[model samples]
Target: MSHSQPDTISAALARGRLGISSVVSFVIAAAAPLTVVAGGATTGYAVTGVTGIPLAYLVVAVVLALFAVGYVAMSRRIINAGAFYTYVSRGLGRPAGAGAAMVALLAYNAMQIGLYGGAGAVLAQFLDGYGVDAPWWVWALVAWAVVAVLGVLRIDLNGRVLAVVLIAECVVALVFDAVMVSHPADGGVSFDTLAPSHVFAAGIGAALVTAITGFVGFEGTVVFSEETRDPRRTIAWATYIALAVTGLLYGFSAWAMSVATGPDRIVEAARADGTDLIFTLVSPHLTDSVITVARVLFITSLFAALLSFHHTVARYLFALGRERVLPPAFGRTSRRTGAPKIGSLVQSGLAAAVLIAYALAEADPIVHLFFWVTVTGGLGVLILMTLTSVAVVGFFARIVHAEGLWRSTIAPNVAAVALGGILAITLGEFDTLLGVAPDSPLRWAFPASYGVAGLLGIVWALILRATRPHVYDAIGLGADRDTTALRTPDLVRHPA
Candidate 1:
């Protein structure tokens, strides 16, 4: 853990790309297709029954909106590339901070690599219906290659591409939802769908889980906190606006889907259509050309989402390296592109390793690799959010004018409590969540990951303290630390 500062960490502050705007920022944040394919309303209906799903969206949106209060409040104060980890480090201490950062890297990397399986399956089905035969992994590898290119490219270019895919697909989704509202289908547009009665229905916890996933890539906007026009204003506004906009899109679309099909029947329909039921439901509702366009948008959205996740992983690595936890090289951004080149390569290598392992095992990419990995990402994110909430409390503990204790401190704190309970339920229901048996491999893989990451982090901290106190001092604490190794009071924390 103790190595002299490598040349990489000493590099000048990155004038990161201004590639992202509030518009594109929001799109990439909200419109990731994998989560939506579970269908916009799918979570609502399944969790609270068709009736309660909309309410779940309202509930999560409002609750997390509370969390965003602290998130944005802190962002205005402290702007940095590292998201939750940075905030935790500032408030909680460097060791906890380093632990969170490395684990987040593990979690997000799992998500990006998981996308390959999902992309492969979707592409395979698209081709198979036309008799252009190939296994899902072929398409998955093709996707992996394309996203790898996007990940290493300059940030502006990547933003533009993501904006296009997200906008087009999201617009198509909205148009169909509009149609569904007017069409009088079972789950379509009824006031009853939004009722509180439905919110408390059968699978409320499950619905909350699904709704939360769509919000996954949203936090990533802060990954480019250093590169944005005004880190303070840009980062805070993006988080709030993105969450508000994404919440509306997801909630409204769910309501519309219910209206398109009767609420009672939408579940049965989804059983047949699966997550893509909304896409297929509206296929016959739209012209052939429009259907093709939506289909194409679907694939590209998946790719854009993958690249978004990939960049997040790189940033996490960059944060760790910059902080001197991992090799300092991971902290380095390419002088040429202003992207985290070293970290990007390391992330891609790890992903390639996982993909190869899955391929070698003849595993079902979507079922095994994608599903398991994404779930791990889900768990990790939940944990980060919870810990980060505690960090928020610690942060406001020292602030003079309590501008948003309720939003940042109380609300998010409450959300974190709810999230903890949900995560516990998720752990217990892993078998049900993954549609596997009690003794399924997934049972071991899921919870085992949490334990493994925790142990490694604890060990790393001990090693740093014993062998590399200097580096350990920098672990969760920021460079804002004086030589005394405590973060300066004026230093701001990032929200998760």
Candidate 2:
């Protein structure tokens, strides 16, 4: 006789935790500092001639805003912690959802792990000024320990800390931009910079790539869904607002940096200042004290970003655990807080391992390391997103509203097409972007990561098929409970 087993989701998830306001703050905070961390390459500054980089950021902000047309629409309909998971499962099936989860795990982790290179490099560079000389990995290990402590804290605590950093950075960057704009070397603010002619000039491609760097952590809104008071409204709002805010902020700074140095000054500025171009541009406008503040904020900005991604990876692991995609271990939550302890532990472990490997490799943790990791990670996420866009169109068809084909079907379809094209162009230009060899290690790692992730999905599905069909059937589904009897958990919480 066949029997039905209790669902892992129902068993795992607990309620009465997160609110909408905090969730909004979390997502916006996460997306803002990506540029300071990732856009260190001269290409971003070179392409747009500094002034045009902000324009490029605005362009992507507009592009992403358009994509959010469908993204928000879908978010309203699908309310699960496992954003990609549910989208794929509803649109495709268990197998596809399973695949997306694997890909997302690898992609997010790669992004997080990539930060070690960035953080270590910045720390090393900053420390080198004071004549402290240890390997970059030494700093990364210290950073990793910090991250591990962060992983164990309350989500709200993380939000409060990030908000302070995000706001401070925004103020610093904007103030610098204002100063640069007010004091242009060449007569006045050039109309040519904002004009379409300058934006698409021969060198604009590199600047556009840098501008794109400002938007990497945009999708982090979904991770806070389970905690949010109203997942749909908050996520929907955060998605658009964060993109716009970060775009404008980065856009203003990039433009200002160009203006401060005058026409054809970005390259020279970079040469004179090295990787400190962004901060250096602002130094003349502020006191030496404020310059120090800006530099410190840059590091803090990365920490905020790390805290945000830490939440994201934990949620992915939690959802996978709750669904039994990987194992029940990930599904287990704290008896007090309802946060997924087991899943958080697993995610933390993986992050630690990746950090250790880079330390062991003794890699030069500069913008180059940051560049390769993000490009690969970005490509990985793009693959997941393309799959999700397809899934959104399909899943919404059967279960969601049947109103306009544009929101659910046509718009997402368009986003998918556009993203695919961008991905193709980016891959073609990877060497150009990095100034590396054709057969460089990154070229292979980028595709290989995607391939490995997809293969892991196949392997996972096979394991589920052989030993855990009940768990397998629950793909893309976040919290589940014992429908037959929830009196126990309630009594435990209340403790009558």
Candidate 3:
């Protein structure tokens, strides 16, 4: 319990620095409501020719809510910034946890770096209007610089930045939705896209996977648990609040787009306007200045997501370092800011390297970099969620706990099955998600990368077991004091 213990002082994040609102802001910013509505939803309609995106978001939200029942229940017992990695380690085994850790790093890095392609493209297009012509990578590097700086500063300061941007983004989205809904096509609103029949029709698999991508960052709630004020309550409230706000925003905005353009024409409009579909729908009703503001908010939305994911990836590294799974250097936090300095720098470096490589290759920033990479990241997360659900059942079954059967067992079992099904569908439609021919190697390559990463992690974990059993045993134990306390029966106990 001593605050000055070398181990605790070395590995601890800034304790009790975040409250519910701050945590919720981080989660929502990562979801990037404006970016998703403007880019993801439109892309889903255009690419899949599916009009049921609104219903898809609602269904994914419900599935995630089921997943959270056990997720938050486990968070109450195990506090770690490693989140999925830590949970899998404790609930499953050290080897699985190690594999989960590698997969998480790959997934989050892909998500974070992919945004630069998006932010860069969006910003470059926005600037072209003002006669400021530049390559997309130039703007991407600008965003990368800003996020790198923010990544090493105080965590709460980053939260404040996200909160400001998220509020404006949500307000603009709702206003746009209202304008679109009020001026429905042919003076009549259509509820066709919201119907179950449309949602369950052919191509529904791709639509559901696209919707799941929009909800990617909500699982990040427990990632900040160790640093939150009253984590047990704050984590749960933030998780649900994030899911509700994002679900409603995405579904409403998508449906409004359908209402603005008749459901029949929604696919055509998305194909024509691409990411600008939402802006184009409202532009005829609003002034040029207001449209400009909305466009700028769209760019900021991408930046906010970059910063949020940067923090998540850095913390995962910090957790791994603290457990000696990687190197102890990763565990060290800045004395002044309590930030994961080494980990943050490492993530920034990786992002910069990827951006440069893509620029050198002359890849299309939006298509090859943004859409393809981020969707692949979403797939990795989907796999992790499925595994974590099974881990929850395993963890609770072995330990003594006060949770009911529903929270401890039933919900997780249901979630595992649900997520596993979605994972299968997503894999089956991976080529569709990437807009590639079914026989293209890119489809298999991206998903296969995670498999390789997971296998490498397992091999490393087994090596650690044989050579460094002490480090292996301490796998998911989190920070220094928590590790000591958790080893005792009073903190967490197993059946005799």
lDDT of 2 at 43: 36
Best by TM-score: 3
lDDT of 1 at 255: 69
- Steric clashes per prediction: 22, 5, 0
Q: Write the per-residue lDDT of candidate 2 for residues 259-290, one digit (tens) a residue.
A: 77775776677556655776666667679888
- Those runs of model 2 whose alpha carbons end farther than 4 Å from true positions after fitting are 1-16, 34-43, 46-52, 127-134, 191-210, 400-403, 480-496
Task: Give per-residue lDDT, candidate 3, residue 43.
Answer: 81
In candidate 1 the C-alpha lDDT for residue 11 amounts to 33
Query: Could you tell me which 10 consecutive residues in candidate 3 have the lowest summed lDDT?
Result: 487-496
Residues 1-496 of candidate 3 have per-residue lDDT tens digits of 2465454235578999999999999999999999999988998898778888899888888899999999999988877899999888878888999999999999999889988999999999999999999999999999999999999899999899899999999999999999999999979999899999965587777788888889889999899998898999999999999999999999999999999999999999999998999999999999999999999999999999999999999999999998899998798887778898889999999999999999999999987888888888888899899999999998988877799999999999999999998888878877777877899998799999999999999999999989998888778887733446766642354211
Cand. 3 Cα-lDDT: 0.90
Instruction: Order the candidate numbers by lDDT, best to worst.
Output: 3, 1, 2
**What does the lDDT read for residue 394 in candidate 1?**
76
lDDT of each: 0.67, 0.66, 0.90
Please tell me which model should have the higher lDDT, number 1 or number 2: 1
Off by over 4 Å in 3: 1-9, 480-483, 489-496
